[model samples]
Target: MNAFKPYPLRDDFTLKNRLVMAPMTTYSSQDDFHVSEEELHYYKLRSKTMGMVIIAATSINDQAQAFDKQITLKSDDYIPSMARLAKAIKEEGAKAIVQLHHGGRMNNPTLYENKEDIVSASAVPAPREGMVTPRALTEEEIHQTIEDFAQATRRSIEAGYDGVELHGANTYLLQQFFSPHSNRRTDAFGGSLTKRMHFIDMLIDRVNEVIKHDATEPFILGYRFSPEEIEDPGITLNDTLALVDMLKDKPLDYLHISLGKYDQSSMRDQTDQEPIAQKIQTVLKRKIPFIGVGKIETRESIDHALSLGYDLVASGMPILVDPNWGETIQLNQPIKTVMPDTLPKPLYDRLAKYRERFQQSGYEFPVEND
Candidate 1:
């Protein structure tokens, strides 16, 4: 349960330690969605103490963007942007991973002039009040979107990242296709459970194809997934377990189970006391390395997570607030709050606004400059 030990990935890379900086969006990119100087400085400050740093969800195409300042790899022009961030992380002694993503129905239409660009598995609105309904992707569009992810993978490889993580969690495009609540398609991409998973299956296959043909060396491929959804008729633990079974068979280097708490149980069935991550691991049966992420900041929580069979532990807010979280945990020292000067203005402002909530959740927020 030593979180500081170096762990080898299935690929050629070996993590310097088992504590990962989870992908958490700062929403601080430049106007054209390139990595800003602030982001590079942020990574440089934070990457020194982590094994792997999974960059926040980045748009694979123009239509994939969700946040105003989200990072993008939609075209070759953006390759330098990612390369700069990768250089920052790797130079600081951590494996750099870019999380490729599409927003789907969650995309804010205001970011696009053409509303039709906001598309998903079906023409359904997200299950939130006053949400905009999205256009359904045509068969050709679906095929192209799959290619978009492949192209994104190629770009990540070219950008000098050690790995690329498919962002299939958090109700994004990938999860939209898999969720019965959002997807109402009847074509080859929807219907039975297997059909619903067709998009992810093809997406993975195409990305792997790109990696095999394009990469000169072994490049890591990882998948992140939410275990369940709150919406009725939405994804359940059984569905996620089945997904885990299929993913274990894929060439993915690891599986990351996204959760709000490290040991959170089923949301769909409160009576099911077993943690959703533990269930997924049982289904995986050690076929793939699993990364468990959530409110894990202290050495005790990290050890607790490892004791539950997780191969690695990840933290988002803790790492964001304290750059030396890994070193603090390793040395059993108190985690200190970062100064406001270390964070991007927007991220700092947002955290400041939600300071109380973050503190309640056990995160140390950035403090004001003395």
Candidate 2:
């Protein structure tokens, strides 16, 4: 039971097991950006069997809100709702982590009263269809955004969460700063890879400063990042390796790699023979724990990811289909990889689109007839 073995993150913080529930956007919060009953229930239902549960990407500032039902940590007023959500997950015996995020250019213009409110690393429009060109954040605004992350960390600690995971993946603000394709700034924030990394470095420093000054309990800080992007000037394996080298000595609890498959090869450089995670680990040299995630749906996939030198394995779709995944593993019972008909209507509705996509991807998450 390697999966069930307790894992120490720091002297003060440890996981009951190595199984993490990867953060998945729920879009179940209220229009006011408050945690909703459905969202709490969603987490409570899934938290029972996991060592740690990373909540969906939550907006750190009001203007950063991107989705209609996104959760927020922009103000003290929202702390109560966050506390309730944390309590719901923690009561199930899992460490609750809220992912702090800013949508940047990915922000929906419709959410803002003024369209120019949307901001990113540069004024470049997102490559995604229908996305508007975002306003480039000023140097002061960039500094302010880093402070916003620190504020969010303080709020997470106040809300009784065990930790906060910085959302640096999925083409968001952090990735926008790191990706040359998105960032055209000529200033200290973007140009050379080192300058591009300045934003992330400052961000980590600020968040850790907040934890050092404020956190009274054992708090873990983790970072999640994508390894590669498809654009010519986008993040490549070499760039990711460089970034990993920079982060190797940071006071981070873990580095989570965002991928579609645990063993997926580099998208940009076909000449690279190793998996992206393995490459990252090579540079990291086990300085910190690495959490690998993709379409991991079975016990065998979890075992394989661990065998590949990942310190922990995370799953998203499998837990959505089977809430008791870890409990079943502990009981030595066969795991169910398909969504059952008895799944709550709200949850099933939330997963409908993903269910279709998972089916097409050949990952078995069949939806039983209601």
Candidate 1 residues lying further than 4 Å off, grouped into runs, are 362-370
In the range 1-370, model 2's lDDT, one tens digit per residue, is 3888888877878889998999987776776878888778778988888899999999999768877678899999999999999999999999999999999999988888887889999898888887888999999999899999999999999999999999999899899999998898899998899999999999999999999999999998999899888987789888888988998888798899999899788887787777777788889999999999987666777788887779888887767766787787567665445655434455567666567775664546654553
State the displacement of the C-alpha of residue 212, model 1, in Å, after optimal TM-score superposition. Answer: 0.7
> What does the lDDT come to for candidate 1?
0.88
- Against the true structure, whose TM-score is highest? 1
Model 2 C-alpha RMSD to native: 2.2
**Candidate 1 per-residue lDDT over residues 131-182, each given as its tens digit:** 5889999999999999999999999999999989999999999999999988
lDDT of 2 at 158: 99
Report how far off residue 132 is in candidate 1 (Å): 0.5
Give residue 291's lDDT in candidate 1 (0 to 100). 96
TM-score of each model, paired residue for residue? 0.97, 0.94
Model 2 residue 191 lDDT? 85
